[model samples]
Target: MRAGNVKRGVVGLVAGVVFAGLTTFSGASAETGGCGLVGTVGTPEIGVDDTNAGLETLPAAEIALPEQIYFRTSTESFNRRWSFAARDGRIYVKEAAAQGGWRSLPLPGCMEGRIAGVSADDDEVMAIDRDGWFFTMDHALSAPKDWNWSTRYGTPLWTGAGNTLPAGTLDWTWSVLSPNEDHVWRDTAGNDHPVGGAKVSHVFALVDGGCRIAYVDPWLPVDHSYELATPANGRFRAVKLSTSASTTLVVNRFGDLYTRLYDFDISGADKVFFRYSYEDQRGLREAPDMLSERVDSGTAAIQLPAPDWVRQPKVPGEITDRISVHKTGIGSDARELRIEGESGGRTGYWVKQLTDAAWRFVATDQPLAGTRLENTAADHSIDESIQPSPYSYAGRSAAGWTATVANFDISNTPTTLRVDVGNGERLDLILHMVDGLRQLPQQRGIGTQARRFDGTVEVPGDILGSLATQPDSIRQFVTSTLGGRRFTDTAVDVTVREFRIDGLSVTLGRS
Candidate 1:
């Protein structure tokens, strides 16, 4: 995670909640609720319409206030009765009473300027301050008679579960919860079991513009388990993240939005294997194999529609800045997404339904025609190994012997061959595989019937003169290739067959 220059504030721990202009809603009245509890009831403050058009706009007078708000709803049964939103650094509580109106919740002095993000299930609300401090408020623990502000507010201690936040988590920009409850992992024996005997909720956050996740399991031990959740490509630096049961909405720094899906194939098995050791009398030992494998299916991140003018011809947009998703009751699938960003020097709000594939202007109700969004290409790599045989030459000549590379098999074509000798002496041969000798018959009676080819590289005259004078000098051979492809069995046998002295050839054993 990258560090930023943020104004850090100190948060004090207070024992009680502060009640200022707090309105109490009866449990019975809140129970007999209406449209607001399950989904958005009336017209939203900015984008969208009755027909569910994408990216529609409204006049300034008709535009609702509090343009920036973080509203969240959960699919949990106990928490499905209400929802919560954070705007202007203040937490607002809303329920079914009076057709679902929002009311400000009183905050203690310590929490007044600390809250940066808020999330709610039907039964409780959780908030994270700007400095990455976590706090939670439960309905049963706070207000039993009504769903209203309670005096009890603090971070959850998890009683005897022995779970705590990861150390050194100083600042996180944003946070959100997965809309669905946690599921159990299936074992190789076809048995389902929870991790640490408890189902867990995933809390994802942006730590210095990088995606990170932590497990929230109230009934289990969670220690030092916060992990990074960025994609393997490492191309997308997320500015915003909103998650559902199956899909997570990601907004990159370029203002392009993507829907990401995770596909994990987990398998585990227990097996017994034998190990051999010379020290043991029996010469073998039995060992247990605990096999565990986790594979990512590499699902492609699909880009969504953005403002028309922002994405022209073949280029991506850089205007989207904010995103909010709404999910229906009992179903953790995103139904609508509200996108707010700058377009043509003017800030605008755009709405996109999951069914619609394009963004439409809210005022005109006309779809924005533009090119489809594109994803970054995945990265690739290659590995190669080459081995060269040692050769020796002993002859009475001022000229050094010629070295030949013969009897080698290469899987891929190489562009250049590098040969390194001792004393800073080296030779590079540009390879032309098609022009080299191929399929020549091998020696008749030696091993199996086969064919062979040879490539020769001349040693420099200066290097040859130095080696001839110092016969005891160490000679080393190393070979490598240059190409963007894999090569296998690229080993060649090097032999000094002959030498040229005074423009006359002399065989290896000749004087």
Candidate 2:
């Protein structure tokens, strides 16, 4: 993929991974008989893909005036999905699963010419004008013309005419509004003619994965083109989806549906990703507990699937460097885990929660040496193909113990040594802790105080008991002891002020 612009990265932490095609998306509904289904905080009033009642339900007959099709679930009872189309300055609602012509609402001053784009949920309806001013009306006979026009000063204009309208409603839902400029005109003979006719100029709705049309000339059934621009809602990937010129649609390296005809049946409800959900909670209307929220509902989870190493089984010695917990929703009770590391080899470590009873290994049986990496500060160039490497604990130690580990990097949780070993292996592991893993103190300090750690030691008898074992045993013993405590890279001055391994003093630093 060609690098367009660097975007923000989301962190996820999970074990199992699931992948499914993005089928249909629906906005949440409010209380019973309210504008819940159609009115989201930041979305357009649209319908979701209910495979039971697919897009084929939309009338195949071509519409005379400009129209946009979307879905809306009713709060009447069993949130029935209704196919809505804003056509010829009128809002038409029909059950997507059922047959019959669309039922038009009482347009009053809209049907003749006033309303350009409109969306409705249940009885609540919204309308836009040529100048981008907004107004709302309820179809309930009780409050006939309860028109509530917008008081906001932001005047939205034609899609490609250097002016912009609010991309979506404050309900966090998608919308379908026409531009101020007319792309279609009719002669006295009643023959519809396209203005600047080669291609059609269309309005765009920047959605989660890509962009879609909000408005297209009904007369011009030809290809609808668009330019790219950041929408008013800055959270979406498309900072902009405007037309480069007046009528030409620019195609990005990623082929979105903007280059095709603005057909909702074919494109589905292609609007902005609904930011409102049980977890994200940005909806204007209270979300009813209908179905479980979308899988991409949480902010902590990644939109895509996990990497190959995460899904595939581990191999012996093969270094499965670092595994990032990109997904959210980890239960609070899960304190200890056995994440498989490399496939096989004399490399691996264990993480035993001091509170937990048993010790478990992650990858190989042999303890792997950790590394002390120092980066040379230098400027780098951004490339299309390059991606930042995930954090890893696979490097060399200074003492030549073929193991590698880095201090804790929370963004990508690397493996940590947990179990204890009998020989010097465990000790050598503790030494790595001196680098980056420093546990923070609970008590508040006056300023940023560099902490000093002092812990008592007991040399094992196997290393010092016999002269024959002392030489080789001492070296091995130190390696294991230091390696085991390599949990933090804190500058710990491990001074032998009073060395007593099992209460025996070693004649080293006795000044």
Candidate 3:
């Protein structure tokens, strides 16, 4: 094997050791209040194999000196497991080797040179060229063995023209900036062009003046959609901007940190989903027909209400060294904000909740040690119902009587039904009757309105039989004997469209 080939195996081993040493030294130095003496550490040089055959490998030394690293949060495929690093205007990639350590992969031809910055999410890797153009490679694609500059990276999908920022934009500690794959566009020729992963929905950068934002309107024509704005009326001269999902953290030049929640009004339709119960009343008992109230329905974005910029309590005598915000997982709304600061040459760490007003000091050498952020918001509850009147059915025959329950024009199916029986037994049913509702073709122009469930439910024959023999009224029989049941739903745990249940009712019939 050539020198480069030999270095590939050796690099993985050495890189692991070097990283371990660095981590140990950092922890020790922080605990001892910077009393440790350390020699000058030189940047490790990577040996690039001249022969471009099979999977390319790099010297282990270079792996430790990355200016920035991008990690993919997917395990569906080998390519999705790949992680990227930016160093000296080039991109290096690695993945876990089946046997154990990390193995270097060839740099994509398009990402070989002039790579200014790189970021990744679960789906794709977004890169910025020296000329301010943006390129991306889908993480779902197979790993490339040899560099094919033209074929690998493809043409710059997003031109940075008119989207330029001030000097030092490249050095900003940005959070993962991935493209919004959910947004797509169609050309005049009717060709459906997927929204470029490089055309991120929002770009927050640290400019010379302060922090600036570039918002890309996915609905508008691509050439005319870039809109730039200053956040919080440019109140603070921001030195860093880190964004994850709906939350953003801003660090000003003076080391003061602030955070805010923001979400674009992508869809105009505002609808709410909830569950409700009806009390037994006389008027509804006299009626035997299906009753419903018409409600406006449409699709809308999921956003926690945006609040004013909230300043986090400062870390006493600490100079901010680095900051990061990460979502708990893919498709999660909760976030963790971690800050690393240095005081008197000793490293210290702090953590704050995304929606909190206080920052807690973490007495650990490692960042984010033992810290786990979770979504604590309560789920959307059902709170609507209709009352039914009392009706004695002592003389009526139970053989030909039936009961029907329904919820029409709903956004989502109720997941559970809790029945409180007179015998004090609580029965819970996992409703799957509305599963077919989602499979039906949706009506056009209806705006997310769908008929979830509208049919008779299985009531115990004994309950209906008792109605004929016992002197209990229909309302008493239905509520106490038949058992009072109500639909329950948790919006966060399930996919919810925008719309209220237009019609929810239960009807009794006698043949």
Candidate 4:
């Protein structure tokens, strides 16, 4: 398994499939106070996970730092095998020759062995193979004390050690040779540690998924991808709760949190739950108020459990003014989202800037704006799970406007789908764009932009929004009376974290 000096091949264009999970995350709170919740834009500090002074909330998203986990370890090491994930644990790096060899780490390239499987947070490790090529690495481990070589793709996993590459940020393209994945420090597992400890000398091994995005200090011009509302004075507006019966509700935002799901009115959609945002962190706060401008007052308590059919009476835990929400509100739902014992998923805030912050990856065709998440389908549920089944959380029969769908479509939108609801309770995410299914291409979605988009397509004030041009049936709406509201406020809980039905003068990526 030792034959890679270099092997690269990436030219994708299928458009669809995503999902995720996390137990404890830190960044959130850009603004969204009046108990309406929803922030993101210049800054809106103040964290919460259990607010309940009045009700209605879903404005939480923060924690995006140092992210580079570990990469830069190449020589082919047993050919190729490396995986990573950190918040607490998870790593793989196969090439063990034989023997049980499932849980390994002794990579240096040129070939070694040991990289089994299994790691949460949505998980990814592709390789594709055949010729089209395959390589997707991202679930980091940690290692960026700065170590410069010159720069093509190395420095900035969080940078430190030696430091280099910051000149223009280096886009480089078309590498002739000398690329990446050297993560350094490899005693060969003989002992120097790192077979599992020292965090495996900085994780990195993603193909097709390419994984590697950390390092955003480009002088901070700002535009890492934004769009936030409901926190000017605060009325809260980042909702979506699930249980799935079929009322609809899609909501999708990425990076830090705000992912919802639900689809099943008669099995036509049949996808019960896959949520995000359930805040109930207790005396939360330990660090993270990134502060651009936001330190509001009042509202922020959660413990939801209203009886009488459930209209918003929770009391499981939560209360906030956010000091740091106990070190960024600790969270974890492990077991890969166990309905039986595994875990679910949710890790958002719109992040994907590899090569370090200086951000640059726009090219599905480039030109097209963004925001394209059409809809349709009265009932839909998927989870063909032939074997490994441990993900479940989109279920509720009478929890007030509920929906937790995304068993799996692959039509696109598979970061792992997320949707949790438990704060002031008032989730009616009913995303029923009903019509064809998929026909993408207000710029792009399916073929000429076919159909079949499930959820996550929020782009109201974004003009340059590009995917192509946007024009797939065109029909955008988000009324609870825009913000006036009548009966659709819950202070938080509506997470889909990334979706697109496509085709309708589309173009999003502003905020």
Candidate 5:
């Protein structure tokens, strides 16, 4: 077998394992310039939602927030989310809860420009402004009074080497690439070399003029930067490839898209190498039949290019219309595969293995908009639907009354309530209450009889606004209906429900 073909075959296998979401990186060699990479896939957080202030003068920089952030010590826990953005000549860190609102960090005057490629983890955060300057912070806040901002390492534990571009580096930089960990760099008298040796993670400097798309990994030689053809007048702005797997999806400044099959070898314990399984640049739009017919009809989006091991079959009808696959969650333990579709005037979702060509139906009363095959030991998965109250709300009332509310929407329509009020008394009640809907009708004393209240009561505003207007309504209702049955505990538990799969949190014990 030809050496090139053999390398392709190996990479193809790795791609299959990555997209399959089945393998662990135990005993595998770690590649330099690849610390952020998970076992087969890095956390796939999409960043196509940032609003750009102006037109395409520079390449759009992208950054994704990690699933969780942890400090060195458990001094405090930040259950609330944190996000970073560059605007108005400053970098702002905003928490989900408006504790401090959006506050600016004390960025050194030198590192002032349009920020691109912002990445943060438990220990540190790194950002590169448009001018090719980088900044790092140990804590995600401004420098303290009389504190040294110049000495602050922009990226905690970052190998400060290779961060600053040499004098001959590009005059204007498009964006900075933020890898999960520091990349190892070798600068032999300004001639970059990836010569095989002990590799350390470090940053690569991209200049204005360059014709190479080089990365040291599974198969490429470390001696030189692999040169690739660029489109006419196309200046390289941003190049974000999937580090999670051996898949290559590159979008140029001209919006020209390309994909390649890349693979690496870590069999030589502590020594890793990478090569292109299929080195040919496969133009996605030109390559017909690479995806399902949905690709041509625009019904589906490409989530991940089919790995070589799981490429589309030549013959149709074998594996017909397939919805787009979406990568969800973070890290090895949190990664999930999901697919969504619309059929028969209803939206549906399915969970299928990366190796499985066919989609398996996910059973649900209402058609699910999407479903994620969570990476867990148990059969746990996240299901998405458009309908309000994807899951029934079951909680104990202040008086220890347990009930379940279904089809509930605090802002809109009424919901069906099944209440189980127990305290040496039994009252079975079914309620269909809506906004502004009042159930303060003539009440009956505690009895063994079953009664149902079906009426349109005005809840006025949203669940919070309406409830806030009448804070003691629940207690009042309970007391009035039960002839002065008062709540023993005055504290009310409030929980803010997060809808996003990755951001899902059910925090309790708040009054």
Candidate 6:
């Protein structure tokens, strides 16, 4: 695109009150520089669908948005701060606060739990840690609803069954339970049954899909022979592995656990990895297999990876994919971006377009064409698709050539632009868009200046006609601000922590 005169939008946010002002022009400003375009257009009154012009070109400066999250006090768990979770349209979470007191609350819902993962509905969340245990107060615990319970911190009050763990296990402090999902996930060792009974090692949820419960072996099996005891009725099946996957799957007293899949061989290239965030010497090497294994005195605690679900390949879309939408970092089973082939049709890869915001999905026959640069009114987040076209500039309009650049012809749009950079420094850019496609020029504060080539002439009548016919089409407003001196993407790091204008970018609310 050729250099067209642009104006700054004069606007301000004072205590959230919107103030309208009349456009003021300087006699001298209208006579020089590149602001000469659209000079005569006085401040114009805009109609519905048009937002006030708020464009601004900030000076080269360092700017940062606060991602420092402020926490809300909780009535549950005694003011202990907790994190947030999202299920369906609702938020689910159990926070861990430092209030230093004990409080209680109902359990979180099943959206995030060992029983049922987040939503298969294609929704997604921010963090996933089977992280801590939570207790719920929302509904009185019955049969344990969906899996998440709220967090509760009692004084040094009851480190119940503390001796159960071999000194080094976690506080085993977090656990949550609601009606349909009730199971205590701990980082320590304990086997106190949720039903108020005793067994070996003492811990287990309705594992194996309510088919059986986990417990220690008779006489606490010396080598840690764990067992998945069958239900009284015995219609469903039970699952248990060698002491290898115990701590990875369940916590137990005496700091001990074993494999969830015993009798298995290591295959080539089939690596296994498990993660538990604990502060230690390298934070790598290995995590405590069972709570007791850390001290090396407990029964069989051979660390092993969990088993994978071995069902039929899904059709890329299903409710089983729900875990992704609710979990912060779990691979999704659903296909939000999937492309299908025609029956005996052209061969190409399938891609599913997730959301319509800064990201867009465009399809093509080539596996490469399936990806595109998506830009929209949502998430200002943009993806770096292709490197700057070094071959040639493809978005330029001729200065009165075949596809001529008429005085006011807005025929072509810019694909993107390379900002002018100086030295090794970078600059930052900010955008302030005005509402409504029309009423733009009037509200825009464009200072006029004489064109370097000519003094003046009758502006083409067709140019004014076109401006009037398609005012709204020019609705998008842009503002760019430079931070450092250079203009490199690696140099200019700007983070937009929040998109405050509610409803415009709907997904910003998620954690």
Strongest candidate by lDDT: 3
Regions more than 4 Å wrong, model 1: 1-90, 95-102, 107-114, 121-123, 139-157, 160-200, 208-224, 244-246, 261-318, 329-335, 342-348, 353-356, 360-511
Give the alpha carbon lDDT tens digit for every residue of 236-336 in model 2: 12212222112112112221111111222112111121111111222223212111111233322111101111111221122221211100111111122
In lDDT terms, how accurate is model 5?
0.27
lDDT for 263 in candidate 6 is 14
- Write the number of the candidate with greater TM-score, choosing between 2 and 3: 3
Q: Write the per-residue lDDT of candidate 3 for residues 1-511, one digit (tens) a residue.
A: 0011222354345335433432122212222223221111111223223332443445443445322222121111122344555556676555523322333434444345656665544333445556544444442123433222211111111111122222345233223322232232211222222221232233344553453443322112222112122233343455456665434676654556666544222111112111111111212211111011112112111211123355666645454535666555332234667676544445456676665666666543433221222212322111122112121111112333222222321222222333333344433333322211121233321233432332212334454445455334444545543354432222211112222222222222211
Off by over 4 Å in 5: 1-80, 96-101, 112-117, 121-123, 139-511
Q: Give all TM-scores, in the order shown.
A: 0.37, 0.22, 0.40, 0.18, 0.26, 0.15
| Model 1 lDDT tens row, 1-511 | 1000110010111111112223221111211121011111010112212231211121112212232233232211113344455555566544322233445566544456556666654234556545444444544112323233222211231222122234433222222222123232222222322221111233444443343333232312233322333332233355555543323455544445555422111100000111111111221211111111111112111111100111111112223434555444332233555555334544444566654666542222222222222222222111112122132223332334232223221211222333333354544433322111222212311123322212223333354445434323223221122121212222232123422222223223211
TM-score of 3: 0.40
Cα shift from native, residue 180, model 5 (Å): 12
How far out, in Å, is residue 445 in model 1?
Answer: 60
Q: Give candidate 6's error at residue 137 in angstroms.
A: 3.2
Instruction: Pick out the ten consecutive residues of candidate 6 with the lowest summed lDDT.
Output: 262-271
RMSD in angstroms between candidate 4 and the native structure over all alpha carbons: 26.7
Per-model lDDT: 0.30, 0.25, 0.34, 0.18, 0.27, 0.19
Candidate 4 lDDT over 1-511, as tens digits, reads 0001110110011001011111111211112111111111011111222212211121211222122211111211111222222211123332222322223222222111222222211111222111111122222111111100110011111111111111221110000000022211111111110000011111112111111111111111111111111111111221211111111111211101111111111111211210111233234331121110012112221111100111111111111110000000111100000000011222111112111222112112112112222112211122122222122234432323223434322221222322233343322232322111111112211123223423332223331133134332121122322232211211111212322323212211111
What ranking of all candidate models by TM-score puts the best one first?
3, 1, 5, 2, 4, 6
How many Å off is the CA of 70 in candidate 1? 7.1
Per-residue alpha-carbon lDDT of candidate 5 for residues 343-397, written as tens digits (9 for 90 to 100): 3444444444333454454422343322222222222111121223333455555
Residue 103 displacement (Å), model 5: 2.5
RMSD of 3: 21.7
After TM-score superposition, the amount by which residue 13's alpha carbon in candidate 1 deviates from its true location, in angstroms, is: 29
- Count backbone clashes in candidate 3: 13
- lDDT of model 5 at residue 224? 18
Q: Could you list the CA RMSD of all candidates, in the order they appear?
A: 23.1, 26.0, 21.7, 26.7, 28.4, 31.7
All candidates in order of lDDT, best leading: 3, 1, 5, 2, 6, 4
Task: For model 4, state the Cα shift of residue 78 in Å.
Answer: 10
